[model samples]
Target: SLPAAAIHRGAPGPSVPESPGAAAAAGSLFRPLSAEDGEQRPAEIESLCMNCFRNGVTRLLLTRIPFFKEIIVSSFACDSCSWSNTEIQSAGRIQEQGVRYTLAITSRQDMNREVVKTDCATARIPELDFEIPAFTQKGVLTTIEGIIDRAVAGLEQDQPIRRVTDEEVASKIDEFIGKLKQLKEVHSPFTFIIDDPSGNSFVENPHAPQKDDALVVTHYRRTPQQAAMLGLEVMGSCCSVVSPLHVLQFNTNCPECNAPANTNMKLVQIPHFKEVIIMATNCDSCGHRTNEVKSGGAIEPQGTRITLQITDPSDMTRDILKSETCSVEIPELEFELGMGALGGKFTTLEGLLKDIRDLVERNPFTLGDSSTPGKTEKLQEFIGKLNEIIEGKTKAHFIMDDPAGNSYLQNVYAPEEDPELKVERYERTFEQNEDLGLNDMKTEGYESEGASGR
Candidate 1:
């Protein structure tokens, strides 16, 4: 199918329409289009109607949404059968990150907020366990209530025929239709979410001038399958297997200055732990150095959580392998280091603490002049306590949670269990698996499945 776009009618008009290979390479949706831009009107073209086999008209408008992206809104109408349809598509590029929008609906007014759902986006009502799968419906520019109304209309459209063909099926559909209608009543609260791997879907914020406490937006890395679906990856590409050499060195370009640089990769196996790949990049022009560690094995069957009580200063000397997927938390201080915050690192507990302190102190959000004095003062207090913890003056608990079960902390007593350390393995949650893209990953019989498809 062609890339998705916004349809002007059947709901609320869409202000933005972006799609895979169709989203604007560089533009902000918030920018307003000036009158001088001179937008073009829709062009009418005679076309055949598939439903009636009669002459129909398709009006297509190719225009940009303000200063945003270019979109094509098309509407087809056939006077003979009184049939009409509408959809929108974009001519821009796919976004680098996937986006998800979650809104809490509490009142009738909330349903009126505008929404843009690309053909590749998935819409869901978590409370009702109802989902509109991707590609099931064409891209739409509608409000929350508009979506429900359209769904109700579609179900009723086939009821008359179903009742004559299969009475039982019609009755079941009628019952489901009733439940769908009740969703718009707003009797209680419910969450409506749109997940678009293409990064083109949008949900308007009701409180535009102010932050909407009821709405949350999340951006995440796309899975390889999603990239393939967007035609970002070439089919039947080369395998990822690398050379067997223990260490490999190559030249590269510096990210900062685009100057000459060198990178080194080495395979290292930690004692009592699995193997890992360590990469170090150095730029002579900029005098910049970076080191990263990556887990070199398949995901384990279960997640692992490790907790260690920090009592003496020597505890900070312990070696720790913190993978990119591992999250660190200091419960007593209420400090947390989210996964991927520090990338992957192989360092001592003291070194990890120093890195955390540096990240906190150097954070742009907290260091700018726009920051509040109260917040800065509180941060200073937290840093003082962190220093005490590092010096063994404060007793605290250090916890590492890894969904991949790849992170590790050294045990001073070789075969004996450390009194201060506790390890627990548990099954990962469905949401966690979704974030990791494991739910849609197919690795076992994929080759055979692809062959069958062929």
Candidate 2:
């Protein structure tokens, strides 16, 4: 197979026949023709077909200006293929917005998978016209080189991976489309493979999950320059081994049998981890092969690895000790998990420790048989004495109004010095009228003196 372009209709192709060592690739074109031949056209021209020959009726003219270095046509056929006996208009350049592009019409398709047609005048974009004689003489190799040279000029580049999702694949396709669309002004035709079967198909372990098995790959057409960059892989029966290109550090050990068990022990990192295994088996007795596998997990002696290690004990001073506060520390306990009604065994270890600490701190007082359990006789005697003192202090400040009116009335007329004599007389009077009681021992003559402040 020249390429999938030979099988898929409308796929873009580039053929270069002019360059050194490229002439051998000339026959790769779809159907070669010359201007001297009689005008001829394919018998089955489908809907959009136009004449491949016009003046003398010869080869189909695909492109002009000789930019495409290679050309290969598909044997694949579809209803869209067509031919017209009438000669088509000459292809020309078109300017849209500010961009310029060479326009050509062919029953052929461009690299972007857009069909080249002339019947639909309403189409916003123009088409390139073609004639047979112009195409065959230019040579495909020269055309391909020219197309590549111009397309890659000043273009940006990126690396992309294609995954299993439809959206991912569509995005990659769209990128190529955009590049081609931008180059429409260059006017030269170019070809690239899209959806090539062998190029696009991926293989992976079938037992792996579908999503995990998915992989992204990069591919390119074989070129001498690319062949030099091919990667090499070495493998054992069970696994593939790869070596690193650079080393971070190295260690010195016994040249042969680099094992810790050996008297002379040193650790080193080779550019590749796999090299360590080989170093380990450097000197082995043929009769007994030491199948020890060197692990890649060995640390490299660099930065933190090379720091001084403290081995000797240092004298401690009181100043070095941290100031501390009293705190309780408990030992962590492990117990065999017991089966329970619930799915898993559970215990409130933290809560239980807290309750135990509370119990120890409380130290509740214990009672003796000499006192009543609820009410202690000694406590009652202490409380009664305290209550009696409080009541006596509360009654000391009280005052009472006189119940005998005559004594109060006579006191107003009597001199302050005669207060004792007046009280003595009031007592005698009250005694004489014991049957009348203190209320009847009143005096009417003292009213005027009491009112006049006498």
Candidate 3:
């Protein structure tokens, strides 16, 4: 039997206003839940067993959260299967924008601060190269120490770390874990970042900061890519059509032909890099096909450059994911791949060369009666050189310059000992950032060379 005041079936109730303190707190904000009868309700429903198909009773408790607003806490238990589950949902309207919280943990006191993380939040400790992606765990009301412990647990179960056979690498990981545990008691400084595209996460901010200091909270509009990843409506005329498995499809005109073409875009999450939207387009009328890759995350503060040499045939198999803002260059051949020249693509070095070869073969500058003998000879020579590189008959350098830091080159089994393959990363210039849309062109910023303070 439930309380009569607690059960409200289908009626309009008075709206409960939020408190000032609740609105100021850097935690979850929610409005009170009321039914048409002016009373809150706790609904009960059937819960199906995940392992076995047995059904059990699920009780949903709707109540006002202490110091917050209202939330629904649901619990379920199966007597036959001995299974249990619990979940929480905020009784508030969805926020229009996402939030990013950055806290610099300098003292043990900072480690004990409360943290409220939603299921849509992604936590990252950049100093340790550790990350917990969205939906890794349910929303949790825990302290900073608890978050670190969860990260440690996730790292222990990581398949890639477990697959590493190098004794030194394994020892390094163990040392990192030990250091993370020590941060709870020790005063080691580190940065803790939580990004939530759903705008449902929060960090307990008891006292408001007066000056620019450690704990910095910033709210940013979700990029089109990030919005798509979170299954939110994009802010544009393009209507997103939901397909199977959360894929988004939309209609677009083919660049080669005027016919209508269907573009399929999906969000791809990479380990080290940020989320990316992979779009594949095809036109049946003109046989035009194109694949484009765009970063679905924030613009990186710094840029990245990857340089690799193709010495053997096996090097051609190395994977490369180039973002639309990235440019490719082969210094040895005096060939440069400008931005948007071939569009963004995810392919092997061999496949990329093949694509370039095909582009050269199809270019009007190389073929047709308008071409001269010298131009034709030069094009043929370049094609021959590309073929040589593909066949491992000659060596060539592959350079990728990405100001957005979204491009990636496989480095798991890379020959770091070889001097031929050089990889370097440096800060991008203000102009470069402006060109990449990272900063406004009119904004004033300090100019720098290869490495200098901004």
lDDT tens per residue, model 3, 1-454? 1122222221222222247464335122222343443553345678787757799777666554332234555666677887766565655434545777888888787886666677778998888787888887876656788788877776676536554766677677778888888777756688899998776666644232112267665555577888888777765674753332577778986654345789989887765556778889898756878887777777677788888877788888877788767778887777766554466788888888898787656443244233458757776787788899999999888899887778887764544444555666789887676455556434443455424752
Each candidate's TM vs. the true structure? Answer: 0.54, 0.14, 0.42
How far in Å is the alpha carbon of 388 misplaced in model 3?
0.7
For residues 1-454, write the lDDT of model 1, one tens digit per residue.
Answer: 1112323332222233355232233233222223343442345789999899999888765544521144567789888998888876754456646789889999977887777788888999988788888887887767899888877898898899999999999999999899889888888889999999887777765332124578877666877788887778744775765454757888876543345688899888888888888889888755768888888888888999999999989999999999888989887887767565577999999999998887666542343232358657777788888999999999999999999898999888767889999999999999778766788887799899999999
Candidate number with the higher TM-score (1 or 2): 1
Q: Would you list the C-alpha lDDT of every candidate in the order shown?
A: 0.74, 0.24, 0.66
**Pick by TM-score: which candidate is best?**
1
| Residue pairs with clashing backbones, model 1 | 4-89, 5-88, 5-89, 6-88, 21-92, 22-92, 23-92, 23-93
lDDT per residue as tens, model 2, 1-454: 1122322323233332445344334332223323332343322223322333222221223222111111322232323333312222213221100111222322122322221222111112222211222122211211222333323432322223333345566576556546545544445543221111112111211111111112221222222322232221222375743355432223332221222222221233332121232122222311222212233342222101001111111101101100010011111111111111011101122222232233222211111121234433433343343233223321111111111211011122223432211221113234223312334436576888788995
Clashes of each: 8, 36, 2
Candidate 2 regions exceeding 4 Å error are: 1-34, 39-76, 79-176, 185-454
CA displacement after TM-score superposition, residue 65 of candidate 3 (Å): 66
